[model samples]
Target: MVLIDRIRYLLEKLLEVFTIFLLLALTSIVLAAVAFRTFGSSIAWYDEVASIGLAWLTFYGANLAALKRAHMGFPGIVSSAPPALRMALFVLSEAIVIGFFAVIAYYGYHVFEILAWDRLVSLPSISLTVTQSAIPISAALFIVCECLTLPEAWKKMRAGVDSEHEAIEEAIRLAEEDLKENRS
Candidate 1:
């Protein structure tokens, strides 16, 4: 359990760092592209590189979200169910998601073979393999996150905690505090 927790925390921090880096890269690319275009000189690699950056951001950002347990869910409905059914549904959902991503990772590696000889349209020096690696990599990272958080998910589900409701309540409480501070 200690090892798992340590690994989970490490992955969480790593994903956060990776997602921020991707966001920064994407922002820099867009700003540079806009400036270049304003000067009547468009960059040839701008479009392709920006799209690649967006793809990487989406992939890595998803892993961060997964690790943080920030994905959309109606916890109220799940918590309202009977204990047995709640556990069953929770287990089933997790299984389906993990299995789906495993399949994606498997086929993603095969995609590598097909893309082996392909180069970027705007930059022939850059290989498609390098840019497209986010698929398998993100899928694997997601599985690791899901597994790490499974125990927490199970405990919350078993305890009949409506996580979404709690989150909304916390947000409201924080907003109220901020409003009070502003008034003071």
Candidate 2:
């Protein structure tokens, strides 16, 4: 359990860092495109490259969000539920999400297989598989992260670690702040 938690924390941090760079790269591409367009010599591949970067950023970001359990949900209703039911609902919700992403991860690998031989016309440096594969990769990582946190959750049920959701929410909040600062 300790080992899994450590690994999950490490992976979550690593992915968070990578996602930051991908976002910055996307921003740089967009800025360059805008600047070049103003001078009437827009790079032909800037848009395409930026689009691919954006896709990677979006999916990877989603995965990171999932790991943190930070994706948006109807918190109002959850908050209104009875205490016992609320906890049950939370577990059920996480389980359902895990199931959904597990399926996504499975099919995502197939998609990667189908697109394995293909390359992007504008960005040949990045294969189609690399882009499509993020889905499954993220799904798999999310599952691992959730699973790692589950034991701790059970341990804290009496005293309530709330660690899984709380930690994710905190991480997401920090990431959002970092993003805003970077944009500024």
Q: Please report the candidate that would top TM-score against the real structure.
A: 1
- Cα lDDT listed for each candidate: 0.91, 0.77
Distance (Å) between predicted and true CA of 157, model 1?
0.4
Cα lDDT of model 2 overall? 0.77
- Number of the predicted model whose lDDT against the real structure is largest: 1
- Let me know the TM-score candidate 2 reaches against the reference structure: 0.73
Candidate 1 lDDT tens digits, 3-33 = 9899998888888888898899899999999
Tell how far residue 135 is off in model 1, in angstroms: 0.3
What TM-score, computed on C-alpha atoms, does each candidate reach? 0.95, 0.73
Q: How well is each residue in 1-184 modelled by candidate 2, as lDDT tens digits? A: 6787788788789889999999899998899899999998978788777877888888788767766656677545565566787678778877897898899889998897789788878768878887677788878877876776666544555344454566679899999999999999
**Candidate 1 local accuracy as lDDT?**
0.91
